[model samples]
Target: MLQARTICATVALAGVVLAAGAVPAAAATAAPARAAVTCPTGWGSGAKSDSDSTATPLSDIRTGRHDCFDRMVVDVPGAASGDLGYSVRYVDRLYQDGSGRHIPVAGGAVLEVRVAAPSYAPETGEPTYPARAGHPLPGVNLTGYRTFRDARFAGSFEGETQVGLGVRARLPFRVLELPGRLVVDVAHTWTAGG
Candidate 1:
């Protein structure tokens, strides 16, 4: 009787150990995987979108061709209750007077980017278009398509500004705005390949 009881207890302990070993395997199968977002052709990488009190963060973004141009839009949040105002549009040229050089426009596709926000003035209730800082704006390029020539910010209109990229054909593209910056990536796809 004593020997039989000892054997039963050992079998129970073994079963417990086997059960413990199965947990991690089950967890590995149960966890969900994250999906990766990538850009299509004529787009760059690292695109994402978000917002804050001072600015609405828009980056790594792209839009399909509508009419004659591709449109990229970004929203700028107001810092205070009435402290936001701006606009955006496309232009034919972007001039740099200090360097005395003109950035050549791309050939195939025309890109138009715009931003609209309110002006921060203590006295005026009317909205005014503020000048964009002459700093470098975001850029987009074309890949896998020879028709694409180059991309650059053309200029601004009223309050809207434009960045133009030359492209040969209108291809599928994607845009992303990650934290602190934005990106646009372009890739080619086929029906057979995943």
Candidate 2:
């Protein structure tokens, strides 16, 4: 009888434990669910954000690669340089910034990056980032980037300088002016990690 009572108690304990477990399982299933976080499309134009012109001139142009996008940074000296605004967009054809002559680039799409700061020194009329004969800026190397095909210095007019980027296709691009630098990020595709 004692053995039988022990077995009955064990069975009752197991039943209570199972009932407790089921309550939590049902509660978990009834809980609300959340959707995955999705990023916005990279292609589009940003509102024109202007700033006071700077004497701190653009000193260098550099490019790098990321998992999702290609980056181009225009190095400047100080706040004056960062405050300089920019206009970046997809264009049908890249023309010389000042003269408007047609410039034939190497890709199916062209991104025109026009900066409010010049790449030259103001006092002596010398270039901070000297223009290369056949290349875009003085020391840009686009050897391995998948989306970037060609880039060129598209001249400076008034208080702005232009840089033409030849890309694989008409993808999205963004221009950001920070203190001492102007940055351009080009998406590799319409979807992330493409």
Candidate 3:
């Protein structure tokens, strides 16, 4: 009985040590640098529409403003069924503020554009393109927005990829691919007021 008790105690101690060592080393790394940007009051609180599509109610939209830009959260319906690949990123030269300052967004105006293909996997709930390999299909262009640039696959948090854009204004945007929807959350930047 004495020997068995000692063995159990030793096993428990080893388990604790192993668990402590299993933590990821990257957790100690510094966070990415962020900038301070402002959003208009109630700016992110309304429905928006794309020229090619109708307006969508702003339910899933979230407010985000960074050093040189503001953002919108595009919530996708969990039960949505479609053959579209979607992504979001910042765009440059899409719109200009009052001071003519081009908005510095992460992706462009066509942030998070996804094209659905026939081979999309239903089980995993992720789009797949054979010709593109690890990337999604090309994105669409916004009419009357000359500064709104193109879109491309970019790195993101949690090992996922997002579509990036280069825009001219610090606009908040959301894209709903299921019903072919896109919403731009426009707010007057603080700089535009003064």
Candidate 4:
């Protein structure tokens, strides 16, 4: 009877150990939970603009995704060369600058990004940025972005080039002028972790 009781106790101990080991294995296989996103404040959705103009040519346009916002960078001559003037405003509809025709943009809201610089070389008038009106901007892919849905070239006429940004909603956004880039960041949520 003593031997039988010892065997039963050992079996129970082994069962407990096996169960404990299974728990860790199961936990290791489970996917990790993503952390909540915290966003910045004071970036309103109304309109952000700078009147400073640049003689430097518009060279490129690019996009990126962040934890709290989606970013659009407009490449141009460095600030050392000249300051870049930009007008970024939310609009009901986007229109081509030179032709005044409607430019189709995909999203719940549109931001008309107007850079106060030409898309062509000033001296030779040769095109520097090949984005055309009423079409998707070259090399810009908005896949899997939380705030940005699409980007379309509105037009480039005179000294300014316009591009339309389509976002999920009229979220808060801010624009910054860096050394050789104009950065536009649109928030993913209204408040922190929202």
Among the numbered candidates, top lDDT falls to 4
C-alpha RMSD of each candidate structure in angstroms: 11.2, 8.1, 19.0, 4.4
User: Candidate 4 local accuracy as lDDT?
Assistant: 0.89
lDDT value for model 2: 0.76
For model 1 the local lDDT of residue 42 reads 38
Q: lDDT of each prediction vs. the true structure?
A: 0.40, 0.76, 0.37, 0.89
Query: Tens-digit lDDT track for model 2 on 156-194?
Result: 667577888888887777677776888888888878545
lDDT for predicted candidate 1 compared with the true structure: 0.40
Candidate 1 local Cα displacement, residue 132, angstroms: 5.3
TM values, all candidates? 0.35, 0.71, 0.28, 0.81
Q: What is the lDDT ranking, best to worst?
A: 4, 2, 1, 3
- Clashing residue pairs found in predicted model 4: 52-85
Q: Write the per-residue lDDT of candidate 4 for residues 1-194, one digit (tens) a residue.
A: 99999999999999999999999899988979887766789889877777888778888999999988999999986554238888999999998886889988999999999999888988899999987778898999898999999999887788899999999999999998888889999999888664
Q: Tell me which of candidates 2 and 3 scores higher on lDDT.
A: 2
For residues 69-108, write the lDDT of model 1, one tens digit per residue.
2334333332343332322223345453335346555554
What candidate 2 gets wrong by more than 4 Å, as runs, is: 1-52, 80-82, 132-134
**What ranking of all candidate models by TM-score puts the best one first?**
4, 2, 1, 3
How far residue 157's Cα lies from its native spot in candidate 3, in Å, is 9.2
CA error at residue 59 for candidate 1, angstroms = 14
